[model samples]
Target chain A: MKLFTKYNRINLSVMAVVFVLSGIAYYLLISNLFIHELDESLNDYKDKLHVFIKQHNELPRFEFFEDIVVTYEPVNVALKKKFVLVSRFNAEEQKESTYRQLTFTEKIGDTYYAFNIAKPVEGTKTLTKTIAATTLVLLLAIVSGSVVLNRIILKKLWKPFYTTLEELGHFKLSRGYVPVFATAGIEEFSFLNRTLSGVMREANNDYRILKEFTENAAHELQTPLAIIRSKLDLVIQEEGLTDSQGLALKSAYTSINRLAKLNQSLLLLTKIENRQFAAVQAIDLEAALKEKLVQFEDFWNAKGITVTADLTATALKANTELVDILLNNMLANAALHTQQGGSVMIRLCPGMLRISNTAVSGSLDNTRLFHRFYKKAAHSQSNGLGLSIIKQICDVQGIGITYRFESGFHHFDLQWPV
Target chain B: MKLLIIEDEKDLSDSIRQYLALEQYTCEVAYEFESALDKICLNEYACIILDITLPNGSGLEILKELKRQGKEDGVLIVSARNSPDDKIVGLNLGADDYLSKPFHLPELGARVAAIIRRKSFSGQNQIVIDHLTLDIRDKTLKNNEEAVPLTRKEYELLLYFVSNKNRVVTKEAIVTHLWGDDVDMADNYDFIYSHIKNLRRKLAEAGCPEYIKAVYGMGYKFSIPS
Candidate 1:
């Protein structure tokens, strides 16, 4: 961001343009004045010579060079021309000594003749150096002036925006309130801030309402479900029932069990989304997996499934609860998907776990595998939240999980930091 | 053995009590927190089944009560809130183990049995099978002062096989229990076969006939012949 701003570059460029322009204007004004002064000095010198000639009412003399040597040549030329024109009346002995001549122009008149002189002005090196020095100094002044000016302008321009940002930065969940102040003379900024505050207010209101609903729903519905399952069990145990009736009750029990798992997964998803997993701990990944494997031995054994695990001794930075959920979900999914005589392999390396089971179905749409309510048509007991639970952990802990059905095997590969 | 059940739902508790009576373990129920606290203070139980949430307070509070009274030597926390937070909290508070709600009744029974063994015997320090007396602590097997030799996996397989004697332990259970989550590359049960063959060989060489027998595609079993 700071690189993009390039404040110094902008300031220097503006200052350079302003300084160059002012120097040009100053140079033009001073040069014009110098030319005007030179014209007046030359005019005075010419006038003095003209009066001197008129007083004697005679031709010019060379002795005039003693007083005004710089103008002698041009004045002498003018006086000689006047003598030639006046000599027609008195063919005087000779014209006054021709003093000077003008090479810039030709004299046309006699008594009132005109001469224009131009001297070669040289050695302007010092003048050029002085101008260069002054220009540099002016450039510096302009740069400093622009910086100061921009400071004032930017402060006023960004004031209300900064104020709003500061207030939002300090906003807390307890108050859920953001301070609003009117923007000064900026329609766009005021409109942007107004829209932001409006959205924040609405989001907070909706969040509070939804949070209350989830909590109420979880609390209210839990007991009734427990009651229904328990009543079903009691009915089964109470008296002798026909086999068909028993099968019907067992099917009902199975659906209830599925519903219960669904409820748990949904509740867990909500809790994770709500940021309610407040616990943190350094979890022993290998030890936790080993424990879960130990617990699941019977589940696999009863179905004649073979489990081969290579769980190494590595630790992870995770909350124990979420870690348990992630591992249990994966293990359960593997156990549910694999065939009775098939092999389920779990390999835990540093920061990665690959769980692969023999695929019962030929191929699967691996894409939507982690989505909620996803289930293989053959394995119907899946409540469809196993991979999704792992996903929730992935989202919260920055872990990554990928699934693939390849070469008659279903593989779930989870990766995280070592 | 007498057990105490601390659960929230009444019907669930009743069903659990009925099941335990069928299993021949005397049981008591405390559906509320205060009643649970009262029960823990009053009686000495072999095992306590606990639930996390209750109307009066949390089952975790009762667990603390048991700990304070210095009587929470054996307990299993049975909870619908099967989150690992509740499990670790319960276990660290001196619970013998934990089981989640909607669990199979047999699983609950298994946890109860494991906990009772842990609280009762501290896990098989010594065992007897036929003429062999195995001291688990010293890792020694003797037939009344004559030491028996066994390989590493053989000894482990022996201990596990005997521990689950008579029960038809499945191949997966043996693999998990014996291997301890280490062999994901094993494609078959050939490893178990070699270990069993070696164990049987060493036992027969020690002037004793084979006590470890294979039940064929199932699992190995250790028993004294009738």
Candidate 2:
């Protein structure tokens, strides 16, 4: 999963396999050398027997040697000189031990005899075992030491990378502040940081440009829209206008007003996103909600919608303007969507606010509800930015908003952090 | 009373001037900052409708100039920037009111009239139209010294009509004026019709002539019947 863990798994496994294979090869090489030495000594013993037989005309006494056994056997045919290994039982130790034995034929006055000389290899075998055990212990120690050292050093070496990751996690485009990465000594990490810095710089630049464009476009539209509206106001006052003309002017006026509102909504959204309303103070939620309710009282009455409120005094630290807009948009949304004679209910607790209104339609598409210009009905008169504006204000104010439909009522809930 | 409109847009300035001209107020126009400053220095006006963004400089500078001269003229700032920052800064600089652009001319007229009334009338803030007397301070209406009770919205609607008397005010303007533009009630003006009907009934009961007339399908015009 982690880079260090993945590298260590592959590195340690390969090292373990190589170490075991080399250890086995080392053991075999050492044992072969021991056998070769034993063979040489046995051959020398055979040569000595020949010399003794020629010099003394008799076989040397076998009891004079230690750890070597010599034997003679009458043979019908002469035996070729060769080396062989044999296992013999030892009376004292009560165990079978391997010996290197040399067999040869010797002639004394036309009599043929077979001679076998054998020597015990128990010490060499013990020596090989000791060397093998020591090698295994040393290999294990080296592997474990390298593993521990690699973990510590690698962790320290990748410290800059983790720091970069943490800083990236906290980066925000709305803050408009680019973070400077700490210089790293490693080339690969340095390159990564450099690339990231360039990307963030570009992103911040693009964001600034986009924000300015939105503000400027909205601002520029305002004057022209004002001129058009003023001209319309003058035109409506002209004498001898027919009712049809008045209707046309009214429709035009409505469209122009809608356009103006849309522009203003976009501007407000941009402002909220830019964090322009940064002044924060403790706002009494109960008082604010009550005030908003009073403002919407006329609309509710006009639509014949019954209103119910259960409010508790709660305080939140947020920008006053933002809170006002958030409350206004939410209440307006509820008032606009509810059918005539529908009931609107509001409940406010310490950290939660819920506003639900009876709706003829079923649940709205929650996924697309907060997206700008997303409307449930094609013929709905709403510009579809009201909920989005509410969502934006809630986001800026650190409030969580959710929408749901239950029991023929559309419910909007706002949660504030304690 | 004399007024000065310092705005860069000629069409908008002319429209405002034309609208207020019907109220018997003389309006002078300045299309740039330097000319506006020259005019402000040269004359005393009852009100100055200042646009914040001018060709040469900001209108706030003109406000500062007015404050430097210690003039007591009422100043109303208009800007296309609907940002609260400009509004706050403009008000802080002693502008009497701040109106964002794309405003209804009637709303502008009402604000300008309010500013002039506050500046000229001082504490004796009242407007008399025929037998109807609107007490601005107490927010009440009187017919020949007989107190006429009016609801809060009725009073406000009556005051708005009195401010822009004899001129057609659209239902949209009245809706925005009463409930603000953020209420999303643009498509429905039935409530406005009811309010107007009630106001007319109440005024007619108080021996006031039929003053409010529906101008075809356009809107309402408050004037003495000819």
Candidate 3:
């Protein structure tokens, strides 16, 4: 069975805690029995030795009694003092024995080189080693069991959350806003997913409504504009238009032209807002850019600006018309902002294209690049939405755009993946 | 022929009526659908110039009513909606033709005149002088119990010829009538010459007396001895 990844990072930490708890419990139970048995057996051995010693009328020596001591030492700490209990009889009729735990006490006078008992603690090392080994085994089992539990039980317990996540992964806003996630019984998760789905639905609903409004407004405005233009045509064709009258007619004509242009720009903005460029196909960017540049050459020449172009054979998967609009807006902005003799230089590399121009330095604000309906206070001749259009195009086409004032040039480098 | 134009804009409808009247077509106007509908129910008109989108209700509804009443009255639907789907729908609902907004008044008059002729008589539905017959609905020329084939465009040129029969039709008028917008694209009038030649040959080979006559540097005419 495969294990869950999320629980693994924490399992070691949680299991370390659980493992320590289980190890301490097991250690307490096993080591207490071990030490109790040692103490009891030692006492019993002492009692037996007492009986034998009294019958023979001899006592144990302090140095030799070390062999019978209870051996208990935690592996974590060293044995500070190693000792055994020894007893002595003052008189034959005395009932109380003088006993002391002695590690270094030596006998003052020993007659006949006699000691009645051999109380040796030499085997305590092996006993302590065995207890330590048992505690170690208990600790290993606790850790392994904790790891197994995290894999088997915790992973299975989080299965519903994973299933919910998989369902959420399949949800997308474009196809439809409806989410198919069934309510999991987990309240926190249910609340979280439901709230997320609700927020998504609201956002999608707002987007759809705005999109519908934009389209409807654009469509509905066309008829009135046609009416106005047709009416204006009649006035222009009327009889007796003299010189000053002709100038007034020209003014009216310019006004109509600007109005029509404004209407077209609004419609274009609405289209871009509605994601009309989403269903783009692979377009030859080189040919498309050349066509745009060629179409604008006459206009730019009339404006007394020179266009230095270097187009290459390159392609990009994007909406052709949007890219066309982007190039037009950028070039038009350059033409408007540059001096009469200024040059707009365009270059293309393997996967990047750069358009650099000499502009009125420090005039364009870098911050108002993408703000809609923002106009510069000083440069009121042209709309300030040129850079915003470029930014939108970049966002939609997945292209990278950077605007910088580098080396006295207004440089815009548009990069796309190959 | 009298035509009633229903449009909300007074100045546009006035200008259209004035232009068509100058073209010698008797025309009237209704600024709203209700008045248009009342006039339509009360009077006989050769054609109705209807706007698809109206203030009170769609002009399509009036066209629908006229259609339901089995009125063979011709209709030309005009609208600002320039999409192809709108044209198809309007035509599907029995509009004889459609014009997008901002159209030339002369163009509108031409279309109205053509639709009226087509509604009144099925394609050149006239015969002249005993030996020649024009069966426009069948797109055939008969010289007593025999028929002949005409190329797709030869038939169109012949119809143009017969419609303006017995009088000279100008080359400019023929281009405007036959080619309409396509005349601007052609380098010369050689294609018109070819179509006229094909029509003449087919009609003559059918043992039909030659009725198509051409004037030098002018246009063609379909004639028979009065």
Candidate 2 chain A: worst-modelled 10 consecutive residues by lDDT: A59-68
Residue A353 lDDT, candidate 2, scale 0-100: 94
Residues A262-338 of candidate 3 have per-residue lDDT tens digits of: 55555556556656656688877777778767655544565556888898888777887678677777766666666
| Highest DockQ against the true fold, candidate | 2
Model 1, A13-60: lDDT tens digits are: 877887778777766666556545545554565566557666765435
| TM-scores vs. true structure, each candidate | 0.56, 0.94, 0.55
TM-score of chain B for predicted candidate 3: 0.59
Question: Which pairs in model 1 have colliding backbones?
Answer: A59-A96, A60-A96, A60-A97, A72-A100, A73-A100, A73-A101, A76-A100, A82-A110, A308-B184
Q: Compared with the real two-chain complex, what DockQ does model 2 have?
A: 0.67
lDDT of 1: 0.67
Score residue A415 of candidate 1 by CA lDDT.
89
Q: Report the error of model 3 at residue B215, Å.
A: 43
Question: What are the DockQ scores of the candidates, in order?
Answer: 0.09, 0.67, 0.07
What does the i-RMS of model 1 come to?
A: 9.5
Predicted candidate 2, C-alpha RMSD: 2.4
**lDDT, residue A184, model 1:** 52
> In model 2, where do residues sit more than 4 Å from their true spots?
A80-84, A107-114, A123-132, A359-367, A404-409, B183-187
